[model samples]
Target: MDDTSRIGAAPRRAGDDVIQVHARLRSMILDCTLEPGSKVTQAELSRLTDAGRTPLREALRMLQQEGLVKAELNKRITIAAFDLDKLDCTYAYRISIEAAAIRVTASLLSTAEFDELDRTLVDMGEAIERRDRDEFEGPHRRFHQMLVSHVQEGARARMAIDADWAERVRRFVMQGDQHSLARADAEHREILEACRARDGVRASRLLASHLARSAFYVAAQLEPTYDTILTRTALRMVLGDELAQTAK
Candidate 1:
């Protein structure tokens, strides 16, 4: 019996291995450590993840379900390729869903939640000073997660995946200058203020605008001709034409 078969002898331990490998693979893909649109063999993955055949196959299935990888005829897996159109679609979905969710979530935040958000903002500022993208991302993601913590699990899960994609694109493309970082920090504070005031409508508009701006900027960097129609439409839906016009 192989090492995988040995591990499979214990059902519970094997199950845990599957979950860990799944998470590891997912993170590697999202972080671009595996590279988008690259063809990878199962042997390569097993070596990279330290996962045996059984667990690696199980984990690949999970990633396939998430649409992160495609199984091929010859057995190599294709990582999902990055595209400008998909980026717009992803941001559009985030703008629509997160805007609506935050409208409800804004008024529901407790004082403790507000305090936590403040700390995240502080952490983000420190990360900016250090010029560390990885450091900034943790608190930055947590800050957004907290905004919709009261929502249904399914919606939150979808939003989390989209958020990961958005962050990945940002890291892959735009190299931030100090000016842009300061602007983003200010935007986060503004959104937090709206939520703190319990103004769901304003908070929703701010969140939508924030997401739209990021989408537009990233799209422009990659392909200036590619109009982000879906993202623009979603922003207009959340913020009316007049405000949406001003948002860009």
Candidate 2:
């Protein structure tokens, strides 16, 4: 078995064991160490996380609900594959929602809140200079989350789901080229400036464009391998069939 399978074979107790296992497995998938379309078994996951079968099963089920895993015939579960069209759709939604959230957040910001955002931006700058992807992603996520969570509690929660989608795209880009990381860092600066200016409208527009640009760049890199039809169809199914129907 491979490292992923090996990691999948560990064990755990209950309560936090279940959450810890889920986070570990999810991190593996997001980092592309697990790869899209990889097969997952509860038995293997139990070994990887050192958790019991019951918790492993529960973790997998939760991942499935989050669109990170898919159940196949015969009870097998596979990591969800990358689909450009679905990614594009997700980018579109993220741009719109997050921009709006930022705008709202900016409108309501206090001195302390602005200072916190500024500090996060500085941390991002340091992370970039150090070329630390791991360090960068944390504060990067927090900065955006703070902006959105200030606007609406639910906004951050919804964006958390979208973050998983973004991670899939990021993993692909990082695997292919390191240059993309610099571009992302630069974009974050622009976002920070807009927020600091307290120009909600401008911030919103910039945020939208920033998100779109990343998707466009990643999609360009994936073009050689991605099937347009397959991506579009998959995204339509995910958005319409799953998310849409579930709300009904």
Candidate 3:
């Protein structure tokens, strides 16, 4: 669906066989290269990625734990569906963690690093102007990575993966509206401005509101049958208790 497979480029070192294999397979699953609800064979993944059996097995096991790949009692392996709570939970924690990351990152960026962020923003704006999803995805992904890079490595890794997952789900729901790109441009500019001013509290609050806005928008569009936290309690937790009260 519009080359979304690359939307979430989870970072990994090239030399680590298991991590590389896992990242490749996970990207496939998230991008729908390995379509949701489809059965996947061990040999098939091995051949597709050219990874050895041991690494492939290890990668699959890890994916299973992440709830992206499911193993059945009958030795079946299936790619998880888009219609899962994994996306919900991903955003729930992502909102909180990423806000914290931005707070730390904004406070810590070097002037040179801040310039790098500006470059990505420029690239993203140009992509949106052209309405080119392919062009946008790279800088967009990089923009997010750049945002959280100043945090601890562990937190950076989680934010990268979770952000990718959240982006995928957002694409599923939003269908790549160009209008949203406009909103994103405006919001991202404000986020960077907060960073420029070195206001961690303002940056963190903006980041939280940015995520909460998306969650609320998606919730409104989902049909009644979907099992999401459009319900008050779950929504508040993700949206932040204070923001939730303010919305009312």
- For model 1 the local lDDT of residue 186 reads 90
**Order of candidate numbers by lDDT, starting with the best:** 1, 3, 2
lDDT of 1 by residue, 1-248 (tens): 56776764644543349989998788687667888889999988888887878998999999899778999988899998868888889999999999999999999999999999999999999998988777888999999999888899999999998887687665554353346667778989999999999999999999898778777877776678999999999999999999988877
- In model 3, the runs with Cα more than 4 Å from the true position are 1-79, 173-178, 225-242
Q: Candidate 3 lDDT (Cα, whole model)?
A: 0.72
**What total of clashing residue pairs does each candidate reach?**
0, 13, 0
User: lDDT of each model, Cα atoms only?
Assistant: 0.85, 0.71, 0.72
Report the C-alpha displacement of residue 30, candidate 3, in angstroms.
6.3
Candidate 2 structure quality by residue, lDDT tens digits, 1-248: 56677675645255337788788888788777787878976666666677776777788888888888997777677888877778767876786678778888877777887788878878877887887767777888787777776755677778988986687676666556777777766777777777778888767765665566566666776575654333333323333455423422
Candidate whose lDDT is highest: 1
What's the distance in Å from true for residue 221, model 2? Answer: 3.4
Query: Which pairs clash (backbone N, Cα, C closer than 3 Å) in model 1?
Result: none
Which is superior by TM-score, 1 or 3?
Answer: 1
For residues 1-248, what per-residue lDDT tens digits would candidate 3 score against the true structure?
A: 57688689765434239988998888677556787789977777777887877788888899888778888776568997765455556666766787778878888889898898899999999988887655777887787787777878898887877776676555543353547777777888898899999987777766666666665555555444555463344446545688768854
Error of 3 at 177 (Å): 3.7
Tell how far residue 148 is off in model 1, in angstroms.
Answer: 3.2
Q: Which lDDT value does model 3 have at 160?
A: 77
RMSD to the true structure for each prediction, in A, is: 5.2, 10.2, 9.8
